[model samples]
Target: MALRRTAYHYYERRLVATLPAERLPRHVGVIADGHRRFAREMTDGEYRASYEAGMRKLEELIEWCAELGIGAVTAWVLSTENLARPAAELDPYFEVLTDLFHRLPRVAQRLHFTLTVSGSLDLLPPDLALAAKAAADQTDGIAAPTMTVNIALCYGGRQEVVDAARSLVADLVAEGVAPEDLPERIDAEGLARNLYAADLPDTDLVIRTSGESRLSGFLLWQSAFAEFAFVDPYWPAFRKVDLLRALRDFTRRERRFGK
Candidate 1:
């Protein structure tokens, strides 16, 4: 099984590399879905392997983008709806993601990628927020390529827009600003500044695993023109080859931006 998987991964990369430069996308996003179902399908030892392997697979995607000179990469680590998952499972889920968030600084240190998170802060427990913030700040002084690692937690693009508008309206009202003057005071760029990924690049591609077809309200506004790829493999079974396959598939599409 291991050998077969390894060979498949190699073949996928080769397929992607064969694409013309003009076929490639500049940015990529991943929806890492379905860890628990994978765990259930495996024995005790195999379960651990799948979990760890999935993580390394995620790292490989990041490394691949950096090597290919892709502009940015985003991962849908957690969605706003995911917060409502069963409490029994939620604790451990939070633990695993937060652990990754904290260790991301080390990965950034080695990979030269800047990391950022976009979502509702109200949804995250305080400590996880601190860990996320710390990891984000560590990149401040380091010089790296324009690689960006975006993690979405409690993030809904529509919700984000609503929140930004709400906050801006509150502030403007407090300042005694008139309603007629609002458009002149706050434009689209100003609204974007209030978004979770305000400073990050808009997405160019979004890959969702586990046979899911919808964005589930992901970085919606930012993903306006992003190429969407749905892979049949579940998140835990997700591999580097699948990522390359997604890229290869993306390469075949003509992103005209409505001409």
Candidate 2:
């Protein structure tokens, strides 16, 4: 055990020392998958316990990002499909998410991060939605946050794009733009303006834990040319070393946005 621990630390230190800070991503997105799986492994299948564990891990990840000088971090906390889960499981999850939204601002403020929530506010319960909005409003004035953390709850990429389109058309109509001129006016910028976190930059590196390789519709629009790193551990087991490894790996890649 002593030898193994030594070797682990040696490798971790090497990775950290060799990291190219100049190549660090401006924005990183994470899909925190397999919370229930991690929970089952740790607590003999207690779903609520698993969620709590995952939340704790998320807090750790945010701190790690700040330590690494990552200016923006986005996490997929919950999806629209998750809303369809049975009440027995969903009820506790809702409470956990709501508590997270309310508690996150305090943590972010202390960490000097501007807190922002993305996705469909209408889909969240009233109190949860309000908590998210209040948190964002409170942090928006931070002139220079150490980082900006985005919690994506009840978010779907396709739905976001569709919503953006609808909002764009409505604005155009309100502005008295004729239907024939709509096609000329509608473009990437128009759609992006209406998407959640429109002011944020596109994802530079997207990491999905638990060995998942698919995006699962997390940030379809923004991650068009992003690099990906899929790790095998469930989210709760994800550690700072794993994140450093991802960063090290990213630094080695040669990104060419489709030439």
Candidate 3:
């Protein structure tokens, strides 16, 4: 075990040394998947334990990104589609997520990061929504934050596009644009400006854990040109080495951006 630990540390150091800081991604999107599976296999189906572990891993991920000078991270913790699960499953996860939100303000302050919880809040339980709002408020006062962390709760990429479209139309209507002329006023840039976090740069890299190779509607518009790295470890078991390797791989890619 000691020897294995020593080798792991050595490999980690090597990965860090090889990473080109200038080539690192400006914004990273994470699909934090497989918490329940991790719990089932590792914790005898105690999902709360798995959720806690995954949240801790997410915190560690933020620190790692900060250490590497990454500007932003968007983590998809809960999706709109996930609301369809049975209450027995979703309730415990919601409880865990609520606890996470309650505790995140302190972490955000210590890490000097701005936290934004973006999603369809009306669909969530009142307590969860309030907790998320409070956490965001607590972190909003940070002046010149070193990084921006977006916790995507109850988010859906398709729904986000729809919301952006609705927002754009509302603005146009408010401006007294004729309904017939509204189509002309609509454009990609206009819709993009209405997205949840329009100020942040587009995602440069997307990392999905638990061996999932599909995006499943994560950042559909933003990640059009982003590179992808899908790893095998569940979110709770994802190690720093996994992230470092993804970074190294990203640096090596010749991103043509759909040219």
Candidate 4:
């Protein structure tokens, strides 16, 4: 049976209201997938419209956290694998990212949220990198209910680990240390500290849009015990209600810490 929009909305709202703000996760990670697909289904205009709407929804989510007194919100803006997309698709995405690079600071200022991009930034074009830097620098003054919004650009979990390992090995080689003795300093903590968003706290919750249930290698190590809430709505179609559902899911979860 086809579900009516009203009924779906009601269910989403009910899910949100049943969970208290006190049950909100301290750190939330969002995988904004299916944007390109959403754009394909709709016209170009609709695609851009959805992207803008998703961005606004992100603003609302961070505000939700600030209002609920949650700590951090990490968003998956792009993935390492996404860089391999065809040129036609890549062109538009790069444009959107460039626009977002400059626009995020203003958004953050309006919400007083801190801005940052995680992952291997070296993969981005020089101009885009500069814009990302600008956005990050503009938000150093947000004081009340400090919130961090991390955008994962050219980010991958397993790759990050491999890169970190390579770096550690390179440093050891430079120091004339034997390779066999590297484990003493190359522990999990060391590997974590070298990650793109290594400074951010571990994720408490991960939200993936577009009905996808898999992590897609978002935050491999950091989300070791993170709670997950998958949404059927596309990135552009997602709303505050979807975020509320994610929060509510976090509330009902029983985190056992792998006991």
Model 4 clash number = 0
For model 1, give the 10-residue run with minimal summed lDDT: 43-52
TM-score of model 4 (CA atoms): 0.85
Candidate lDDT values, in order: 0.76, 0.88, 0.94, 0.78
TM-score of each: 0.86, 0.93, 0.97, 0.85
lDDT, candidate 2, 1-259, per-residue tens: 9998888889878888988789999899999999877866887878888888788889999998898899899999899998888887777777877777777778877788998788887987888888888988888777668898999988998998998999999999999999999999899999989988887889999999999899999889999999999999898888878998899999999999889
What is the number of residue pairs that collide in model 1? 0
lDDT of 4 by residue, 1-259 (tens): 3567778778866775687767778789999887777777775645555566666666666776676667788888778788887776666667677887787777777777788787787888888878887888888776762778888878898987788788777777789888788778677877777777777889999999998899999888889999889999888777777777678768888899799
Candidate 4 least-lDDT 10 residues? 43-52
Candidate 3 lDDT, 1-259, residue by residue in tens: 9999999999999999999999999999999999989999999999888988998999999999998999999999999999998897789888888998998889888889999987999999999999999999999899789999999999999999999999999999999999999999999999999998888899999999999899999999899999999999999999989999999999999999999
lDDT leader = 3
Q: After superposition, how far is residue 48 of candidate 2 from its true place, in Å?
A: 1.5
lDDT of 4: 0.78
Q: Write the per-residue lDDT of candidate 1 for residues 52-144, one digit (tens) a residue.
A: 556666777778777777767877777778788777656666666677777788888788888887787667888777777788888766685
- The order of the candidates by TM-score, greatest first, is 3, 2, 1, 4
Off by over 4 Å in 4: 1-17, 44-50, 167-179
Q: Of models 2 and 3, which has the larger TM-score?
A: 3
Clashes of 3: 0
Q: Rate residue 30 of model 3 by lDDT.
A: 98
Q: How many clashes does each candidate structure show, in the order listed?
A: 0, 0, 0, 0
